[model samples]
Target: MRFGPRLLMALGAAASLLAACDSAPITGRSQMMLVSESEERQMGLQAYQQVLSKEALSHDAQVTALVDKIGRRIAAAAERPPGELWRAPRFRWEFKTVDNKEPNAFCLPGGKVVVYTGILPITRTEAGLAVVVGHEVAHALARHGAERMSDQMVAQVGATAAGVALAATVGGSNRRYVPMMMAALGAGATVGYLLPMSRAQESEADRIGLVLMALAGYDPREAIGVWERMRAANTGKHTAEWLSTHPADSTRLADIRHWLPEAMRYYRPRD
Candidate 1:
């Protein structure tokens, strides 16, 4: 039997989706990616600029110098001749130390990295700081954000398809309930798929970040110390928000410990 136009379209979409799956650079882990690197980079740049517009940048030259120094080194180390795991050789890397009290830092797509002043105490020396920057850059290098967006896109597409299928089964009177059913399905997808994938991404970043720092001439073992300090700093605060979005400190520390040996193979001290 010949396929209908709709059936043909669906088959083509499925084939395209399968073709879109890619492996991450260093870890070679399979990732569902629908967005293009250039598109993700553009979105990252826009978001980076918007964040800079709202957050106050650090005025202390010392803090800025340290962050820039470490960030540049990480970027250099992460940038592996255009075809490596950190594939975006064209990324115009930018680093800024934000004058914030929150112990947080992130690297946006296209190599935009921001460090909060509060994290400096925990990071301590330049090598310790390298640990943090390396992990953040790992997130960008792995294209975790784009993977997430791709996951969401898939969920939305599935949701829409489900809605259409449901509408076909229901009578006119029951058709009105399709939207409610779709909403619930969307919620379930978020809880079941998106959240868990985010946790995985965090863990993957931790793994790759260690290797990047080690390769960049920074001691990879310092990563454990940095996380230990972070755990100490976050002792009494409510962890629900952070834990929901990230791997627990203990879990991360354990993973770092497990991966340290492999990371060490890449380590070479730079003068």
Candidate 2:
């Protein structure tokens, strides 16, 4: 049998390593924060400006009201940033309805958000809209972007360390690992910019989002219908994939169901 002391020491060191990571405000779970807050906000601002300049926005009275109604609720309900570095000073929570048929939406750092007009029909109702906005806001509040960056950094560091160790042992270098530099860049985009973060992040968003919608005077039950409608609307070649950047629709819907009970705990209907 392996020695108990050695095993315990290993566990202790791992726990200590994890302690160095930052913790999110609401979940209070330690997270790997590879990028600073200012840089995140900077990218968010520039990206938002680029999107607005390039895309045509819809001026439908109903759409604007719906987006603003839900956005205000989610932003207000979300937990304030836990640390001093991420103050909500920059948050204005603007929601613009862009004329795109992509059935997509996003929240930038500092609370800038936009919904594509194509998503409106899928949303169907204000509460349904809340479900989408709340989920996006929850993503920001949890700082999933920075955590994803940290994950990429860790992966690269591991690759480089392994490459050095192999070179030391075999008295040779592995050129095959050279492509790994691209993998790191791809992984950073995959996790931080182009895709979602861990299962924990997704789960947390569902839980917190449900509560945010409820507090905003929206019916959280509408979330189920919202996703169902979204699933029905996607007639793309791969109706199998909801969006390239998000969790698989069925998996994400299931996760929402699993966390419904917990999310309800914080639900407070608006007066």
Candidate 3:
């Protein structure tokens, strides 16, 4: 099947866009994912191995046990979707606490979760820990990382197209400036579009995490407390939501409050 160059380009672009279009579970939000689930898991496994090799895994039994216990409970709850089909069974869930001072936690694809030791002080209770862990888990379940990668992939394609167009329009000496102009365009796309997409993903994770924790028999209302404490903990250091890849703590807390009633319906208090 021989096709013209323009026809081939059009077909390739259409296929790429269609291949990247997917919907997130629970939230039902549309996502673009250039990578397959298996591919994402493989990348996650490699990243996990690399991280564990370089970073110090926590030795504190008490913290490690707490994180593991809460993580399992949340993972179990997340598996039982609310009448929605999902990819829980395929996950090879693992939880590890890292000996880091940063108040951060993340769950990679295939359920590889890492909790930084510094976040424990803010997440003082088991339920509080669930809030953080559940949120990280939600990011994985929602495939936000893959979506971000897809967005970057699309941006790279756009940059390449723009560079080609610039080359066709500009003269010899002016061609030298095309690289710098393309760099600026890439940066502008990242700051204007990609950052906002990331922030939206963070908000979606917050909403889904609340439900997961609630279903795990943790109090949904406690999510607010967790964010409130987080807000207080990072008072002077908080970035404006528009400028950062995450919603400001106060904004997150507000959204959590708004979504509490719905999350409450899933609350199944632990016996």
Candidate 4:
């Protein structure tokens, strides 16, 4: 079962409810999450299947070879979930490229990955590709999507229950309800998802991705160059769908600087 301490703490103060908490790995901070490992695994697997079924796989041999080469290396370094799940040994991992023009890529909850060819020119090298792969893979290993959904669950349940509690303690009038609900929506977005995940999650990804790349024997520093190219590619606008979801490129790049010393400890320079 999952748990959220902040919500529980509020209840404890207001109505005497018990609270529990857990730390997010690497970052090591207690967070309000209540999603199970099994539930997250199911979501990842189902999402992977859906993406594969809906998207057209690319037949380009060059792209296929590049992805295969880089993907295996990154996966070998990623010693979590998708790897640890090798317990009963039922599923196989596959990497495929899709023939889309969008400069985008993602790794679903399972080990399923989709790389769009349009991003190739920006990546431009084996090391550059490793940087992209490592970050996306980090997202999956951290169970970010599950964290996102679990956050939604907490807000939905907490607000409904909390509002009524407040009404019982204070008053059951709609005057209090309207302003409270609107405030919850705005605050929930900033505190719930945006502020929580936006800064912290990107930092986590940078830390994990660098270690993964280092273990994979790509110069972990290549990630810096890759992001530089990524920024340049965007030209006039630094804001894009990828930037918004992942975090500001500047923030992420600065974070990369901070993690380099730690990541280098694991880096095995290529022979």
- The 0-to-1 C-alpha lDDT of every candidate, in the order given, reads 0.75, 0.63, 0.76, 0.63
Superposed Cα deviation of residue 242, candidate 2 (Å): 13
Tens digits of per-residue lDDT for model 1, 1-271: 9998777667766665676688876678899766667766776777678779999999999889988888788778877623454565567889999999999988776788899998989999899999989888888788876677667656766732432332342213332332332232123445566777878887888888888888889999999899999999988964663435578888889989999998898889997
TM-score, cand. 4 vs. native: 0.72
Which residues of candidate 1, in runs, are more than 4 Å off? 81-88, 159-189, 238-243
Q: Count of backbone clashes for each model?
A: 1, 0, 0, 1
On a 0 to 100 scale, what is the lDDT of residue 60 in model 2? 83
Model 2: CA > 4 A from native: 1-20, 25-28, 79-90, 156-200, 235-245
TM-score of each: 0.84, 0.70, 0.85, 0.72
Model 2, 225-249: lDDT tens per residue?
8877776775464423323445666
Sort by lDDT, top down from the best: 3, 1, 4, 2
| Candidate 3: segments with Cα more than 4 A from true spot | 1-4, 85-89, 159-189
Please say which candidate is ahead in TM-score: 2 or 4. Answer: 4
Pairs in clash, predicted candidate 4: 2-34
Which lDDT value does model 4 have at 55? Answer: 82
Q: Model 4 off-target regions past 4 Å? A: 1-20, 80-92, 159-196, 240-243
Which scores better on lDDT, 2 or 3? 3
- In model 1, the Cα lDDT at residue 71 comes to 79
